[model samples]
Target: MTDTDNVSRRRFLQATGGAASAVALAGCTGGDDSDTETTTTDSGGDSKERNLKITWRPLDTLDPVASTDSASGWVIQQVNDTLANYKNGAVEIESRLATDWSIEDNTKYTFTLAKDAKFHNGKKVTAQDVVYSFERLAASDSSRRASFILNDLGVKHETKTVTKDGEEVEEYKPNSLAVNAEDEHTVSIELSEPFHASLPMLAYTSFSVIPEGIIGDVGDYEGEMSQKKFAKQPVGAGPFKFDQWQQDTKAVVKRFDDYHGKVPEVAGVHWQLISDDTARYTYQMNKNADMFNIPTSKFDPNKVSVEKTDDMGRKHGTYGPVRNGDTVNFGRVGGISNHYVGFNCEKVDKKVRQAFAYALNQETVSNNIFKGRSKPAQHFTPPAIFPGGASGYDEHAKKYPYDSSKAQLQKAKELMKEAGYGKDKKLDITLTTYDANVYIEISKLLRDKLASAYMNISVEPVKFPTLVNRGRNGKLEVYTLGWLMDYPAPDNFLKLLYPPKTDTSKKGMASYVNWSGTEAAKKATEAWDKIQANTKPTEEAQKARNEAYLTMEEANWEDAVMIPLDHPYEDRMSYDWIDVPMFGGAGRSRQMLNTAKFTGKRN
Candidate 1:
């Protein structure tokens, strides 16, 4: 439902560094003495002048059209305003840029722009801006999410043949997309078919409205700036404005006074790029960061005391009294994502893939590696978005359950032997993964477990970006990656395994397993086609769609396309004085500090 660059879809956990090394480096105590030098007040005598500080990993591009990862999306959410957005802590969509919208015939959508909405540039938002934004999103070569508009949403568009160099090639007709500025403040969009998830899909950052004629790439009118400049210093109608970005160091955004919504109480937000687990932990313990994540290496279950759990499965608690003697508020929610070991189906035989899947135990990984902080994932789709929701996940999970039992190990050995591999003729393959300590540890476990199954597994640790590039180029025989939800829908997760997305020629970022040429692929393709056909909101249609999801998942199980490891829990540690949004199924990337309030002094 959401469009992201292939790399964006692959989310990296915040925790880095080995557990032993991290604990040894920082101890179970506080930060350095020098880190305690805190500024209590600003020139205006407000203690909140230092603003809210958060630790994050390195970000990719900031351009909404080009950004695919959650790192960039988090900052983008601050500087951009989409037509609709997920309500905080919930998947329900709410109006943002548009005051309200109406749907007709389940295909056509009409939105009435907020009369008071104004861009950071002080220009009034209009229907033309919305039209231009959607058009650019579809036509711009830089847009990784163009498919979300053209294909996934089934937006009506026309193509025309134009001669380039010596041959003729087809491209979208200028302004031919089925979006129209009906008036100064009304915009209408027509879809090729009725899509049940259209509203939620529109909530993605890719549909964020920017001033029309700002860039020269999509339309003939170009006035403001180049695409590159806009990416670095974007102007939007959100509550925050782009301040500065220093590559791998940090990015800052200042509050916009003229924001249409309730403005942020703080002066700005400072996102510190701290990739080291110890450093992030120390920074938070020192009270330098108002809100941050507690690395698994530094997390102690005994220190956590849960007060209650919400209906949405969010746990509210307090964690603390560390060596620094600080007790911070804590929150935990099941993440809408799945981390897995993917096989290149074109290079690895199906039986070998199945053998590896059976050999690796998800429960062991969840317990030993994640320390019970995550749930074992049996299906590619996380339970929150699985067909029929979390209630039915266990039923479908029974279709293909892989455990580390002796019997399963025996089954794995048999599969490997049937694939013409044995102790003497072991099938050698390398699993490339992000150079994070957790992933490396998981890979090593997998290597050790598969050894008995006559599979010689080598673990290759690379930077996150490098891992993504290798997977995209089909240079990896096997790899470790994870998919975060772009939207809360079964189709969003299922579409990743859709057969056509496996076509390297089309530059598919998902389905690195490339099972497009196998019999399982044929069955999956049939189910995928059916899923597309049953997009209507009728009860029968929804039932048929759920059945298709199961069929496709069964096909994946039969082929062992990928091994679903575990669904991690998103945990947050923040000073009790700082009230942060408990973003549950809505996703952490959409966490907005604008609504956050400073309730009391940090003791």
Candidate 2:
């Protein structure tokens, strides 16, 4: 999920940030003293020693519980293994740490852990570890996604409202979450209600099993280390182990020999922090980085050639014979996310919001800014999971049009005039966004366009963390951000626009856009309520849910709570010698490098 800056797996993917080391080359040695050199035989029967160097943005946190952005998720996933994972390029769940699972009565889920799975410290994974992990995640004050497990999935937990520094806060009761260890290798979870997306939700990295009693205060077990130390150097049962993390520079992870899954083809992975798009492109072009995302400024659609598109819409191809005269492998897929400009509805008038939405051309912005790599989003939910699916998306999009044209401009001018802003009275506001080149460019374009509609917009680009903090505190009036899917479900996207989730009084995450006190909010909430009550498997129930989604979409559009921008395409370029796996659009944050191999000699 991206808020403008960090692309957290389900939290945020900063349009710019990632977690990587500052290594100059893939083969260079730079990590903790525990790092060792190893050689692996390639498919061609040739043995070579190499470290996978990848380009990434700055990471926010590595603590899985507290991680809400993709930059941190990218690294946390490497060091932690979840019970299940999405099949490559699909929403289908596949086994990871848990070999098999069973769901009974829709509310009871039992997972059998793989007996062979071992933590980085060589501790065998047990049912107790899984229980401890879930409990810790549920109770941690630092966890940004506690609600996902506690409420979304309906995990049975007890909470008490307490006053902290004169402010009310909800605290979880000890040993109340209905997660239990049935046996040494089996774990059982009881939910407060049946949820269809429970399995997929459990696949989230926040539920990753760590060594039992590794960190204290959240669980009954006495911990071996402080939570602070664990965040810096976490140990888990994933394919890779945390080796070193240099703040703002890079994070290195060495392959774990005791990993139960297929061992990594490379000795380790060197995540190089190249936040600058141009610098990252240069790093890959210079052969310093093996795999990287092609910057929009550097992307040439003419140079891209698609070989095939999978069932899930993942395009596999080659990039180009660029300035280096080499054609690199390419992959592209539509992200299950949307980027938009949100308004603090409490502060910004509805007419003003509608005027701004009318004045901005989503298609033009997406085409010009993203080089035609993204599709203009008419609704918050991407077409892949929009209501009744693709057809439902088309119907709603046509019913509510927000694209800019001569007519739209006229409407915007009229609305601005009605809102008491005209030639003499101008609506001046600052548009806050992450300090990324792409957002800066987008903000500038918006500023220029809105100026004609009697609105003077100032662009304020702050760090990704600051932008998120200000947004949560309702300190931002107008801001640009994006939401990547937490799961492959419509509710994940729709919930963002749900007024209650953005109520500052409720300490909402997206509270910058305070739309809770409006008629539109009530309508959207009603639709959301209908959706929750209609989760049965019957055809009628499904139809009602889809209709409710349409209602929510309509409510959001009519009120102009947020100006939906575009659905971005996830694209990547890798050196021809590397066999980089294509993850398609979903679960990019859970992308694992263990399967990546050096197929040939690197140039």
Candidate 3:
């Protein structure tokens, strides 16, 4: 399989703006400029650098920690630069004010400052600046980007009693938190324990280092600084700097004169927020947007480069280019995401869930609706995250093929009959989904198929915000949602459905609320806890961890908590002027600053 076919899920979300927290309106095509045609060569820098009109949905916020939308991320992709970034196959630590580093231990690391790395304000980036940037992230009240950093410093949240002077004070203290500036050029971070996810955590845009002076200059930086301010006017040590933001319309970034790395090829970057897929596609067609994502329906092979590959050794059917003559590139969108149908464990019975699962026609959805955009899935855990995941799942496929009118349906009917969900006793179920044409179609299709088994399936279309709230509140009967992995690893996926029982857990996004509270699943979650708790587990530890992941998946799936569907692929269109390798994680490609060069094409 080509990189496009066996697309790593990590890169897929980055392409589609995996951080999207809500729906946004697509950009309205500005009045056509056909009246004023100026001819110029398409070569980079041959003409004056014009404002780049990249299209995406508007973001909710720009606060690194709080903003989860792709629009916000695309903007941040320009203004902010991370300490270590993923590029060309590995995590390359940029010399963004920091030239080098030394790891004292698993819990302790020290970075050497780059004398020339300066902020947009022309202030020299110091070890103290790095320390301040981290402190703000740790104490911020917005989102939880701080927790990732604190965890990197081996700081665990623990409730404890301490004696201050002569009195005893009981409180919760963040464990092993200490940052010391050894000198003007070096800083050290001491942690309580070793954590594995640290490097990847730093890859997050939220952890991008900011000017220390900016924080103190603006008192109460966390409370006062809004994403609007950040998006409209941002300051960072990246190759590019923020210029202006037009709030849901567009934003601009110019090259930073003092950028420490190899200077960027382009002079400036611009963004046009477009929520509607068709509008975004049209912008690309009209040559307004240099790059934009397209849906499976409008995917045109004739437009761009396409390839097919088999990354997963298993027999996942060929997912690209039916004919080389077709111009549109076809393949899968990667990242750890599962398009699974989840049942409200509290409301749905096991028999009912299994019956519904059996009756659901995933092949039809994959073939007709998805248009071969996705592969039919059988397991809850996807192949990309878990090691040997494809191998383990290949065994299950022999037992279950895509068959809608077979013993599986018969079994479902028998289960429904036993559970009193038949012609005389139909169970009322409301399947909730957000406003996506594909998802809406899936819900309607399932509703029609379930009618064969005489089950009442009500299709409820809710707003995106309400959809998220309903899943978090555990109030929906059935819900359709997708999980794009934040990072590569089984832990990220496992943590979702298996958050701690307390309200303070991180798995709020998990749709299988029933399995999370169940005794067997809880036990599986505890086993995962033990694995993460280890200071430095041996190879055996990881092997055991993969085994645990399967245990968790089986525990949840056997209980009919969630049903796997398909892994959907996205179609992206870009003018030849926009050049970036399309086979990496989300952050790697599409960032205007990362591409060697991008030029506007006028046809």
- Candidate RMSDs in Å, in order, are 8.2, 8.0, 8.6
Give TM per candidate: 0.89, 0.90, 0.77
- Predicted candidate 1 versus true structure: per-residue lDDT over 1-603, tens digit per residue: 222211110120111113212211111012321221233343433534546678887777788887777888888998999987866735656668877766677777888888999999999999999989998888887787887888778899998998766767666676889999999989989999887678778888888899999888887876588888888888888988888887767788888888888788776777887667787777777777778877777778788889998666688898888658988888887877888888888899888888878777888788777877788888888877676566688777876756533227788899888999887999889989876667888999878888899988889998666776677777789888887777767788888788778654344355566667778889899998998898886679989998999988888888888778888888888876777678856567876668875666554
Clashes of each: 3, 25, 24
Ranking by lDDT: 1, 2, 3
- Segments in model 1 whose C-alpha atoms lie over 4 Å from true places: 1-48, 160-174, 404-407
lDDT of each: 0.76, 0.76, 0.56
- Residue 249 miss distance in model 1 (angstroms): 1.6
Candidate 2, which segments miss by more than 4 Å at Cα? Answer: 1-48, 161-171, 220-222, 404-407, 508-511
lDDT of 2 by residue, 322-393 (tens): 668888888887777788888988889999888878877877877888888888778888877776565667
